[model samples]
Structure formats: C-alpha cells, structure tokens
Target: MSQGKLSPRQKMINLMYLIFIAMLALNMSKEVLSAFGLLEKKITNANVATSERNVAFMESLSTMALEQPEQYAAVKRKADQVSEISATLDAYLGDIKRQMMTTLKAEDFEDFEVQDQPDFLDQR
Candidate 1:
C-alpha cells in the first residue's frame, strides 16, 4: 500500500473498491428515501384517523346539544368555533401544498419514482 506506482493488479483492486463503495452509498440512499416515504405515509394515515375521530366527536356534541340545550349548547358553540378554525387552517395548508406541487411540477409527492431532482425544493 505504498504511495509509489502500483502493479496493475493493485490498481484494479483499488478501482473495484471504489466501485463497491459507490454502490453501497447509492443503495443506502435508496433505503433512506424509502424510509422517509414510509414515514410520510404513516403520518398521513394518522392525520386521517385523527380527523375522523374529531368528526365523530363533533357529531356527538351536536347530538348532546340538541338533547340538552341548556348544558351542551355553549359547549357545542365552542366546538363549532374550533371546527371552523381547523377548517380554515386546513384550507390554508392545502393551498400551500398545492403551491409546492405546482412549483415542483409534481403530480404526486408520494410517487417518489417520478421525482428526479433531489434539489428541486432547495433551489426554490
């Protein structure tokens, strides 16, 4: 392993080593990207579940308010306010996502295979 000129066999071994290292790096990158995609999907699913639960809870509040207006009406009003705010925020965030997709020229962010430019977002 001297710094001096090496034999052809040694040079070939070094080139192979370099190639192997590059391959490992590429494989690791793909695995990391896959993990990120899976995480995003899990988070999206959880958000959907949470939204469903919130809707169910809101419905129950509506029922309670109708059944006992004296006690639950105020509570229902507050709940309705929260729901309205949530809807507004959700719409704002959705608009932001649409803008991002438009800027990226992406049909679907979940389709990682179609995303070729890793630095597209960075450039913006």
Candidate 2:
C-alpha cells in the first residue's frame, strides 16, 4: 500500500500481526499434538485388551485340545505357530522402537508435550 516508507505505527502494527499469527500457529500445533497423544493412548489400550483376549482364547483352545485331541490338536498347533510368529514380530518391532528412542534421546516414548522441532530422523 505505501509506496515510499512505512510510519513507526505501521511498523509496530505489522510486527504485532506477525507475532499474533505465529502464536495462533503454535497453539494449533500443540492442540494437534495433544490429539495425537490421546489417540496413541487409546490404540495402546486397545492392543493390550486384544492381547489379553487372545491369550484367553488360546488357553480355551488348549483345554479343548486336551479333551479331544483328534479334533482340536491340529487347530491348537496352528494357533501356537501363529502366536510364535506374532511374538517374533512383536520383539522385532520393539527392538526397532528402542533403537529409535535411543537415537532421539527420549526418556519416555509417550511424552509428546515437547515443542515441535525439525524431523531428527531425517537428519540421520
């Protein structure tokens, strides 16, 4: 709008505008990060519940196999194999998570309240 130069008041107004916009952006990012943290917590809880249910089901299957070996033994064996594979994959993923936390120097994996920074994984 101004062709030549801006007045002192105009400069202050422009500076305040920039600061206001930056504050809004910062607030929005925090809110989004908080939402993500909540979602992560919910997913973790669900996983734990599902794991517990799976264990109970496996136990039931084992009992059934004991009662009727010819009918349920094969099914139980297959379930055990699947369980073993799942354990292996879980351990592998856990190791990867530990490595990431070590690299990031993070004390707690669930802590997401820290300020946003550039992607450290990208630096690697």
Candidate 3:
C-alpha cells in the first residue's frame, strides 16, 4: 500500500501513541516548572530572612552605641561582621537552590524565624 494508506487498527495505534507522548510531555514540563518555582521561592525566602537579621543586628548595634558610647566602635565592628556573614550565607543559599533538583520542595527548609536576644535587664 501507498504511504497514504492506513488501516483502522493502524490509525488507532497511532492516535494512542500520540496521546501517550503528549501526556509524558505535559508531566515533564510540570515537574520542570515546579522545580523553578521552588528554587525561586527558596532564594527569595533566604534573602528576606538574611535582610531581617541584618536589620535587627544593625539596630542592636545602634542601641549599644546609644547606651554605651565607649563600646560603640566595638559594637559597630561586630555588626559589620554579622552583616557580611549574613550576606555570604544568603549568596550560598541562592547557589544551593540553583543547583538543587526539582524533588527538593519548600517543605525541606525549616521556617525562618528571628528570635530577639534577651536584654540583660530582662534576665532578672
């Protein structure tokens, strides 16, 4: 038979093959998209947490500066160091998210919560 000729059985089989291929394509695309979303979310959350920590530490340093001028320089230095470390950690998290597989979801990360350190007066 010519290439144009197809029996009913052959047509059915071809249709089934096409449907199967489409489903596989859809599933794989979904997985890839989800992976990208997961990575984006992780990077964003890490960035936000680091930013909050930096702000809180900076505020604490400023408080120390106001309360004890004699220790202002030391407090400022420590705050700077903390900021740098936090920035480095944020960058590393971004890199890890970029390299992680799709199977790693947002649930894998612990919730990012900042706890305020107790002031000396509060310890009494």
lDDT of each: 0.80, 0.81, 0.66
Q: Which stretches of candidate 1 lie over 4 Å from their true place?
A: 1-34, 105-108, 111-124
- TM-scores of the candidates are 0.60, 0.63, 0.35
Over 1-124, each residue of candidate 2 has an lDDT whose tens digit, in order, gives 6668988998999999999999987665666877888997899899999999999999999999999999999999999999999999989987865666664445645666552443545566
Q: Give the range where candidate 3 is weakest over 10 consecutive residues by summed lDDT.
A: 111-120
Q: What is the lDDT ranking, best to worst?
A: 2, 1, 3
Displacement of the residue 56 alpha carbon in candidate 2, Å: 0.8
Best by lDDT: 2
Candidate 3: regions farther than 4 A off: 1-33, 81-124
Candidate with the larger lDDT of 2 and 3 = 2
For model 2 the TM-score comes to 0.63
- Candidate 3 lDDT over 81-104, as tens digits, reads 877987799689767545542233
